[model samples]
Target: MTDLLPLWRDLLLGGFILLAYTTEAMTGFGSIVIALSLGALILPIDDVQTVLVPLNICMTGFLSWRHRNHIDWRLLGRLIMPFMLAGTVLGYWVQPVLGGALLKVGFALLVLWFVLRELRRAARGHVAAPKSGWWSRGIVLGAGVTHGLFASGGPLLVYGLAGLSLDKARFRATLILVWFSLNSLLTLLYLNQGRLQPLAPHVLAYLPLIPLGIVLGERLHHRVDEVTFRLWIYRVLAVSASALLLASLLQLG
Candidate 1:
């Protein structure tokens, strides 16, 4: 029983990481949110966060490299990075007190809201983005906080990006750069708090699958057009958001 337990745990962990990273590679975000929400059911949320942060940073860094030329360095430096870092500072402070289960549930609720909002936008045939200004900045900062706390800030950030009217390649590249920078800080924070020690072995075991998922995801990203991409993104978000919300509610019950 003991031997079988570890095998099952590793399998679940590997599967979640593969799926999440693939999504991240294709979309340039969503890996941490997707993986953490699902992985929390199989492993402790804190442990999953610790183990996955480093892996996510590494994966995003790789994707950033792969699409280096497409990154919006100006936007990342001027707005996204600083705002997201600020959010992480606040998120880290409140995380310990909020408790893991509540945090996960809250993140799921947030994602659900974004998914629904995007669906409504899509259905209305609304292509012109809202004007970019303070409101847009607020959205990005809000995404930063959620990201800092739960690592699921992609959907909110996507809303902000939509307003910028970026091309598909720039969108993915910019997201990869933003996550790489933000998650690098998160990894250091995890290390300082000693949250990563126990996860060392699991990290090594899961490392091999990371690149495989990224390669496959990269292929998919290249093939997808702007319209098809948005359609697929929301579809995935709706299903995953619903699943996470359901899982969190079950935990409460």
Candidate 2:
């Protein structure tokens, strides 16, 4: 029974990885967020993040390379990356000071509001005003902080990006590049802190699922129209935020 227990855990972990990464591959974000949310049911959240963060680089790197031409470098370099990176540094420094439950609950409420508003607009056939000025940048900054704290900042990032009206291809490709850059920085930090050494074996064990997830996601990505693709993004944000809210509330209780 003891031996079988380990096998069952491994299988569950693999299943979670497959499902999470497939979502990311299709949408260009959400793998870590979804994986952490679901995997926490079976594994420690810290362990789940340690394993997923490094592994995400592999998935994002491949998609970035394969769709390099589709990336909107001007938007990424000028707006998203710089603001997000700054926020990440700030978030990392303050993580110990700010409690996890507070941050998670706050973030969940913010995401839920944004996603619900967007979904309602879509349902009414109203076009969303393009995000501009400091508002969009602020959202990107918040996403960076979330990424730094949890390595699952996709919801906020997606919310910010949706304003740009990117096509599905550019949307997926550009977001993948953003994640690749951010995750690389995170991996370096982990290495400096010697946090990844103990987790290396688990990372290797789950590495195979990356390619498989990407393949499945690619096939599904093509079937969805642009409108449906946008809708799916909002739906993912709603689901992720709701889960985060529930988890945080549970912890508080």
Candidate 3:
């Protein structure tokens, strides 16, 4: 098992878990990136992921079940999952060969480009029609690769899915199911590699936060209108991309 963290650090991590999972519960994605980014301050990034990925399974699984009726099964099984899974496998295979900094910078730039374009259009009161064809598929594939690399593929996935112009409920529900599937794969990988053993205590301790986050976030989710929700999604994407870029650049420096 990994060495136990100091009590204060553990408490801080719990706080981060609460905040991050709450966001995921409300938005249907972001728990891993948000928690890992914050938790990395107190723990190694790898350790943070080891703990958070499994914890994400709990959050996503419950949300997926709760919102099961709203999922867009056709969109998920036909388009998103297949491309993303292929990219994820490829990404995992090549992870040892590629430099992490380069991949992160590239992914961040890609997300920022899409997000800024969408935000500008939104500002002009122009809603771009849902994207299709190879271009959208490519985005989802790249998102899978990023997920494999850093468990932070959410922004790109969001970007790709936003084009479909799903209503807030379907959008949130479908995305959470995608996360449920992806994170479960990650958890199984971790288990087979024996990574989860060391992090079991942390995982258990953090598990309670999931339901609390769901309760709070579900209430908030009901209040936001569709337009405001979409706007905030882009805003969150912008923030996530910016943070990823800054972190990658800092690491390079």
Candidate 4:
């Protein structure tokens, strides 16, 4: 019973991770944002990053490699690379320094931003997102840093891509490519600093399920139409955002 109980717990968490991955594979983002905040419900905050740091690496890299044939190399190099590097450095510097409450507030703000942006976009006739330039570049860079500091960086980077009105497959493949580089770099940094401890053992145990989940998700994603999938995306974004806001406020209060 004791052994089975632990297995169940792991499965439960892995299940959550799986569902998050499904959305990412299906529509190409939100898993991280949703997973990061939702992970807090199942694990301690410090431990959340520890577990996710490795999982993100495995998931991001695998998905990217699996779908690499579909990735836009230009988009990745131009938009994702510079910002992720910058964000990682900044995250390392700032993460341990911030007060818990303040950090929670910042996290909540990001969640709110994602929720609002998606809602607004949906309301604005679901038109494509405007092209980003200088400010948006900085936005992506800042988001990259936040991703390093906190795994929830999905809202900033992923939601921004919605403006492009990419079809689900393109969005999924491109995000996997970007996250492969971003999360891999962050994972290495964490490994160097010794934050990669408990994650590996847990990740190894859960590794078998990722491939299964990806295959299943990919099939379903291909089956869905663009409009339906996107509505589902917004639904999740709104739910996660509201959940994040409540969680952060509860923590701060």
- Candidate 1 collision pairs: none
Off by over 4 Å in 1: none
Q: Residue by residue across 5-88, what tens digits does model 3's lDDT show?
A: 587899998998898888888888887877766666567767888898888888888888988999999999888999988877
Say which candidate scores most in lDDT: 2
* Per-residue alpha-carbon lDDT of candidate 2 for residues 45-141, written as tens digits (9 for 90 to 100): 6778888999999999999999999999999998899999998888777877873777788988998998889888898998877787688899899
Candidate 4 lDDT over 1-253, as tens digits, reads 8879767767777877787777766766667666656766656666666666677667778788887778877767787677766876787678778626567667666667766776777778767655567766777787777776776566677655546645567677887766767777777877888877656787677677667767777887888898778777767777667766665666666
Please write out the lDDT profile of model 1 over residues 84-124, one tens digit for every residue: 77877777778778645566677777777877887888899
lDDT of 2: 0.86
Error of 3 at 184 (Å): 0.8
Compute the lDDT of residue 56 as modeled in candidate 2.
Answer: 98
Model 1, global lDDT: 0.80
Question: TM-score of predicted model 1?
Answer: 0.93
Residue 17 CA displacement from its true place in model 1, Å: 0.7
Candidate 3 residue 192 C-alpha distance from true site, Å: 1.6
Alpha-carbon lDDT, every model: 0.80, 0.86, 0.82, 0.70
Preferred candidate (lDDT higher): 3 or 4: 3
TM-score of each: 0.93, 0.95, 0.92, 0.86
